[model samples]
Target: MNLYWHRRDLRGTDNRGLARAVSVSEGPVAPVFVFDPTVLEHAAPVRVACLLEALEGLRAWYRERGSDLLVVRGEASDAIPRLAAEYEADAVVWADDYSGLARERDRAVTAALEDDGVACESVHDSIHHEPGSITPNEGAHYSVFSYFWKKWRDREKREPLEPPAADALADVAGDPLPSRSELGFDKPTATPQSVTQAAARERTTEFCSGPIYRYADNRDKPAVDGTSRLSVHLKWGTIGIRKVYAATQRAAERATTDDDRESVAAFQRQLAWREFYAHVLAFNPETVTENFSGYEHPIPWRNDPDELAAWKAGETGYPIVDAGMRQLQAEGWIHNRVRMLVASFLTKDLLIDWREGYDWFRRNLADHETANDVGGWQWAGSTGTDAQPYFRVFNPMKQGREYDPDADYIREYIPELEGVPADAIHDWHDLDPDRRAQLAPSYPAPIVDHGERREGAIAAFEQARGE
Candidate 1:
């Protein structure tokens, strides 16, 4: 018998690692999941809630297969090996996780299992390609995405494997799944759009059907349902990365227009970006806390408590930034463009440390991936590899007017801006005092002048870089 451990990969469908465990097992395979308290402490309330919901669905899936997802609560290093010994399993199989914490835990678990004479098998199922698989001639990973993208596109992707069917099963009764209260987290008021594999599959089909055709033109616009809201699903492994890639390929093959094909390719590039960040994280694990670029030393940061509080409360007085923050609070998600804008505003415009924004997002974003969040925050803050130039500051007002041209996105999240005219929404501060008062009386004034802050940020960057 073999033990199949579930981590982020929650689903039974197209799970290569799970398939591998069943294929190689001499008898029935015991599927197990452990909820580690240490890990839960780092997860946000919304993330924990979403994870539990997904696990509930996964448990049902396992039951339908005449087996159970043996649930446990403890450190995985201890829980997994103990379970292996209890079941007398010959091998423990699981998908490899690339996060810093996961890597450390895996090492400890592997060492413990080795001492017990149980073999451990791992499969790279979450990402299309294994992290660190693609690399430059001289380096272990690519810092620039363009270089990574070219190699990524040229490499053949693995076809998703079918889920394993176990004829026999472990006879042990599973522990009852824990609740949010039991996990020391409240059930968040806001959660993910869906938590089941069925929902993720339906979304993938629907997106590939038509939305992908127009993705290029509409993806950056925040007001419409233009982009695939699949990050959370991907993060939780409700759907496999290869399945999404295959769906995109099918969409491309069926495309009648060049634009459609281009859009499909564009969306696939985003998948590459996801892997790109993962690769960076795998090679430079220290980037999680240290700046990837190594140029953040002696940098000046305002770190104003009032400004940070305002930013967190979505009262920055910049409509776009406020709207994004409010959206994050309300839905536990935000648009990609708005994410960059908000990060830029915090790190550059507000002169705050990027780590502050990174930590906040880590605790707030329902779709949080350590690598992607770190990559994005560092990119926006100009402290990451191949990051944006530090001297370049994002003008939140211009971004608001540009991406959310009709101001619908702003109005959707910030009620105070609802009555403001579309023409005046992005420049509400520039309006006549009487009209500004009449339109958005409750809205606060700009927290910091963008023009002055932009110069200050540039000067600080110059000093940090010793210009």
Candidate 2:
């Protein structure tokens, strides 16, 4: 029997690693998942909650097939080799994970398995294209996304693999899965929507059915449920990338109008972006901590504890920024546009280190993926490849008026402004102290002058660049 080491790919259906295990196994494949303390150390409450839920869903799937997912707790190096000997497995198989720490873990596991005389196989199951598969002619990966996107779009994608047959799985039973508390994690402050494969599949079908057609128009408008909320699923590996892309293709085929077709393409573009960051991270793992495009001089980020705390508490008095931050606290997710805006606000307006924002999001977001999280923070901080230029700081007021025009998205999260007029809400930063008090006395005034900060941010960037 071959032992299938389940990592992020929690789902049985459309899993490449499981299929590979079955293919090579002489008998039914044994499956195991190790909750290593090393990995859990980097995890937060929200992500741990989601992980437990995803594991439960996976366990249910295995139980239905007369097999059980092995839930073990130990260092993978020790646990995996021991399991291989216990199961008397000839080989171990797993899906590829793209992060420096993950890569380190894999190396340790591989060495231990080899010492036990067991072979190993790791497949590229998560993303459609492997890191080195899509890249520039010279560099290991493309620094600019557009150049990468064109090649990624044109590259032929692989078909989604079918789940292993029930007969192909080992009939060994596993102990009852542990709860979040059992794993020493507190209850998540903000919970994510159901993160099972069922939820993911249903969401994909519903999104591709009609919402995809209006995605381009409604994606920027946070009030509308325009974009597919598939990030958490993708992060947890509840759904496969091939399946996501296939859904978009079907959506495009159903489109009757040019605009509808374009909308589908727009959503697909986001998928490409996800992969683009993955490739970039694979080649440049240090970019996670260090700037991808570093300046000659270090960025003079302000060490203002009060300002940072206010931003974290959604009390910075920037209405739109506050709403986005509050939405993260409430739902464990924020709209994509709002994510950029809040990130820009933190890195520019407050001049705080991007690492602070990245760490906060890492702990709070249920869908936090290392590559995407770091890439986005650096992009907003103007320290990433193909990122927004340093000179173009986002205007929170203009952004609020344009994206949340009716203040619907803002009001949905920030209830203090629920009764305030849309105009007054958008102009909250500009409103005088007495006028603001009269409108929404509960809400605080703007913490900093955005106009002054924008100019200051630009000058700071120029100084760092030595220009």
Candidate 3:
């Protein structure tokens, strides 16, 4: 018998590892998922709840085919080997994960399985390409995204695997799935609308069918529904990256005009960016804590608890910044452009450490991912490889006026600013004293002068870099 272990790749459809397990097995394949406490304890509550929802979906899918997902809870090393021995399984297969902790866990499980005479196989199903597959002439990982993107675009991506047939699964009785509270988390009442594979497929189809034609022009606008909104699904592996990439490629081919083609290309580039960050994380695992550039000098961070508190509360007095923060709290996700802006404000404007913001995001984001989160934070803090230059501070006021010119995104989250005029919302603090007084008392003024803080932040970076 063959055993297939499910990790982040929760979906039954187009799963490479499951297909491989079925292909190699002379007998039925027993699909199992173990809720590893070591990984779950450090995970975000919302994300854990989402994973449970996905698992329930997968369980239902398996049951419809007269099979069941063998759900277990404990250390994977012990549980997997025990389950394998009980089932008399000779081979175990699973999708590969690139994170440091995941790699370590896999090593332990693999060693234990080998000791029991069980072969372990890992399929790189989650990402379009494995980390080391695409590289420079030196055969090392590409630290620069442009070089990586060039190679990535030229490489051919394999077609997504078909879902396993009904007879492929073993008719094995399984334990009941656990609830959020049972897993040591508060019960999450609602599954976000975009949690399931059906929703993800529908969204991807809708995007490639229509919205993708305008993605180049509209993706950065926070108020517009221009994005694919597939990140959450991608995070949980509800939809395979291959399916999304294939769909977008088809869209690009079907393009009737140059503008349409440009839009499709732009959207595809975002996918490349996702892979790029994953590649960065795979190579520089220590980037989770240390700066990627290895700037040894200490950056003098502020000890203003009130400032940090206000930033987290979405009352930073910057409309754009507050709007993004509020969205994160309300929906467990935020716009990508606003994410960069908010990260800049935290590290540069507030003089707080990037790790602080990274922690908050790790705890709250429904799509929380360690690699992407670290890459983003380090980029904003100007400490990553190919980071945003430290001197080029993001002016929040300009950002609000530029991207959210109508102040629609701000008003949507910050209700207090709803009544304020679009122009005034972006510069409420700079208005005449009478005009400022006329605004609601509930709305606070800017926490710090941008011009003053800009110089101070630049000086701090220079000092740290020994310029």
Best by TM-score: 2
The model with the greater lDDT, 1 or 2, is 2
Question: lDDT at 78 for candidate 1?
Answer: 95
Judging by TM-score, tell me the better candidate of 2 and 3: 2
Model 1 scores a TM of: 0.98
Off by over 4 Å in 1: 166-172
Candidate 2 per-residue C-alpha lDDT over 1-467 given as tens digits, one digit per residue, 9 for 90 to 100: 99999999999988999999999899999889999999999999999989989999999999999999998999999999999999999999999999999999999999999988999999999999999998688979999999998999999988878888899999998888778888889988896888999999999999999999999999999998888999999999999888999989989999999999999999999999999999988989998899999798999998599999999999999999999999899889999999999999999999999999999999899999999999999999999979999999999999999998999999998889879999999888888899999888899899999999988899889999998
Best by lDDT: 2
Q: Rate the local accuracy (lDDT) of all candidates.
A: 0.89, 0.93, 0.88
Report the lDDT tens digits of candidate 3 across residue range 317-398: 8989999998888888989999999999999999899999999998888888788899899999999867999999999999
Give the lowest summed-lDDT range of ten residues in model 1: 164-173
Task: Superpose all Cα atoms of candidate 2 onto the true structure and report the RMSD in Å to 1 decimal.
Answer: 0.7
Worst 10 residues of 3 by lDDT: 186-195
